[model samples]
Target: MKRWSRAAVVAVSAVAATALVLTGCSGSNKGAGGGSSSPANGDAASTVKQAADVMAKVTGMHVSLTVQGSVPNLAVTKLDGDVSNTPQTVATGTATLVVGKNPVDSKFVFVDGHLYSDVADPGKYADYGNGASIYDVSTLLDPNRGLAKLLSNLQNPKVVGSEQINGIPTTKISGTSSADDITTLAGARLSPKDAQNTPTTVWIASDGSYHLVKIEISPVQNGTVTMTMSDWGKQVTATKPA
Candidate 1:
């Protein structure tokens, strides 16, 4: 196992949704978890509540992420992976790192309470500690404390407009939220220095499902981060790295 910097660990598990890209790992099983709720477009508040409920019931899905200027000194340009909810919390994906004028590829996997990344020699893995596993899988869709739950805490959610996400028409909403809230969504505890209330934007499916189609969060110093989720109700399986 390779040692990962504490800062990277914090960003991966604590601020991935707002300031990092790792939080994109999440999924669920409908039988073990709750089902989607009714879509509410009666008003902005109702819409958010409905979407939040639908998102909380997600059992498993694919997550595609793009982050800019998030991690200090590390310019990550792209990350895409699968988030599972059947077995245990696990997120496995590949990332594109931009260095100088070139892009580099790397692999990352979190399973069984352990994180492995950038494998170089065969059988040699850099371990990022057991605490580095993906955010609580069961609660990944929990409306009370899940990503949607955190977004609900944003101040004054307003329907900015509507847009098409992956061809699905979606209602766009924007609001302001605290960095603390973002960290809470990632399922990682944080210290005072890591807090930075930030502005956030979310897009919800307008077809009546109220599923979360996209989210954008911007912190003061960190660059803007955007995440797109799809394949709702999809099945995902993660195996421990060999």
Candidate 2:
């Protein structure tokens, strides 16, 4: 597998960092919400808000992401990792990138406010200044700017139905959000055309906790980005490379 350049990796990190922003919506919606375990009396907007609130307080979670199609500058096709937000935000994960039609894997760790990756120097970590600027996974837990905000800002939200995700019951909600809002949260630059209304879907745990389980976003006409989160509050440790 061919390793990508620093610039390319930076682009990949930006998108990978935004993987956790799956918790929120950005505008108002009108729809009847009724599900087996719907929150806020089966109101779609209310249910989404509750889930966003719950996600805001999460300290740690396991996240997985998959991207289909293209986004400017973003090269990562898949990422799986554990992220911690309390005390100090940190994350460690495996990232896969498609280079020249071939997939390459890399190991990454964020600790002490910097991103370290083996892509630049095979078998050794290379320092990438300012993890937050490069790939701030902590943003996923931000109440004001991350998932919470996204959920509250969702447009035309409606409770479509219910489904089981990873064996956990979840209520499904669908809506649209502006591309600009998503770009801000993800910290990735998107094409002007993508600034139009983007379709979004969220699945919140129906088990009363209202934790966010999955989110899907269509940023372009034929491209989709999906994120799944689990193991909320899990203990995660990221150590500086030796």
* Top-scoring candidate (lDDT): 2
TM-score of each: 0.68, 0.78
The regions of model 2 sitting more than 4 angstroms off are 1-41, 99-101, 131-135, 185-187
Candidate 1 lDDT tens digits, 117-168: 6634334557756422422333445456567676567678888788899999
Clashes of each: 9, 13
TM-score for candidate 2, residues paired by index: 0.78
lDDT of each: 0.66, 0.77
* Candidate No. with top TM-score: 2
Worst 10 residues of 2 by lDDT: 23-32
CA RMSD of all predictions:
24.7, 23.7
